[model samples]
Target: NAGVTQTPKFRILKIGQSMTLQCTQDMNHNYMYWYRQDPGMGLKLIYYSVGAGITDKGEVPNGYNVSRSTTEDFPLRLELAAPSQTSVYFCASSWRATNEKLFFGSGTQLSVL
Candidate 1:
């Protein structure tokens, strides 16, 4: 089982361009989240899904969208890439919320030019 896998490990987007960062986990976790980590800052939640049909906005959901149509996938969409959005994007999952440990992907390094 591939715990968590993200594609296009690195990307460079021009201003206003759009892209989708793919995320998938094989652990069958019910709690999935997308977070961005900026230099010297802690992880900021972008979007999260409690389950397959429930999604919610998080701390930094301004330029992102998410969908959880299955137990293993939770992809994040960037409608208009901006330089300010440049950061490391991580996809994480947990079997349960309370006191559960999260499993994180290596992350996608995105640069907006």
Candidate 2:
């Protein structure tokens, strides 16, 4: 089974364009998260979900949104993309939120100009 999958490995958008980065896992994980990595920075949390119908904002939640309607999918939405939002997006899943290791997707590289 695919542990985690993210579509459109690479995408380029003009300023103000919108897109959704899809993420899915077949591991039945309870915790799902979205993170963005900049050129020289560590992963920054964008949003997360503890379970279906439960989602919370992370360190940087502005310009993004997420929904957890099932244990298998947590999609990140960018309503109006900006150059500042361009980064490598990673989706991760873990059985537990405390100490469990996260299984990450390949990542989606987004560029907004």
Candidate 3:
């Protein structure tokens, strides 16, 4: 089974362009999250979903949005991309709480100019 998948592994965006980073998991996990990892920095949450139809903003939600419509998919949308938004985006899943270890996708490297 595909544990977790992310599309367009790499992307470069103009100052104000928009893009969506896709994520999917076959584990039927109840919790999913979108996080950004800057060079030498720990991951920072952008958005998260506890289950299908439930979503919430997290630490760095400024330029990102998310939706959870199925047990297997959660996507992150970036609007008006900016240089500050350039970072490695990771989609992760866990069957339980944040205290548990997470299963993460390889990551999408984003660059904004």
Candidate 4:
């Protein structure tokens, strides 16, 4: 969606490599989140930032990192890619945690070999 954008819709990574999943939103939402979904699984929060310069870990944070230097940008970083890390990543933003009017990116599919 235009409101939330995620680059590199699909990716293949070698084990031990690193990459950053870019997510940007034009909605100016205060709360942004990074979620991962494995096959047949619901979205699992990897990280979230309430505002710029403030971030915290979520349900799944191992092998991943995130930073919110600006309200429009929240990038998720995989320091060391692994097989288990391969999944579909979705970036979403909401004015609050109430899930009202939450906007989501198309999603990025990552495969690790």
Best by lDDT: 2
RMSD of each: 0.8, 0.7, 0.8, 1.1
Model 3 poorest 10 in a row by lDDT: 95-104
Clashing pairs in 4: none
lDDT (tens digit, per residue) of candidate 4 on 5-87: 99989999999999999999998899999999999999999999999999999999999999999999999999889999999
Say what the RMSD of model 3 is. 0.8
Inter-residue clash pairs, candidate 3: none
How many residue pairs clash in all the candidates, one count each? 0, 0, 0, 0
Model 1 Cα shift for residue 64 (angstroms): 0.5
- Write model 2 residue lDDT over 79-98, tens digit each, in one string: 98999998999999999783
Alpha-carbon lDDT, every model = 0.94, 0.95, 0.94, 0.94
Shift in Å, residue 105, candidate 2:
0.2
Off by over 4 Å in 3: none
Candidate 1 Cα outliers beyond 4 Å, as residue runs: none
TM-scores for every predicted model = 0.97, 0.97, 0.97, 0.96
Instruction: Give a tens-digit lDDT track for model 3, residues 11-87.
Output: 99999999999999999899999999999999999999999999999999997888898989999999998999999
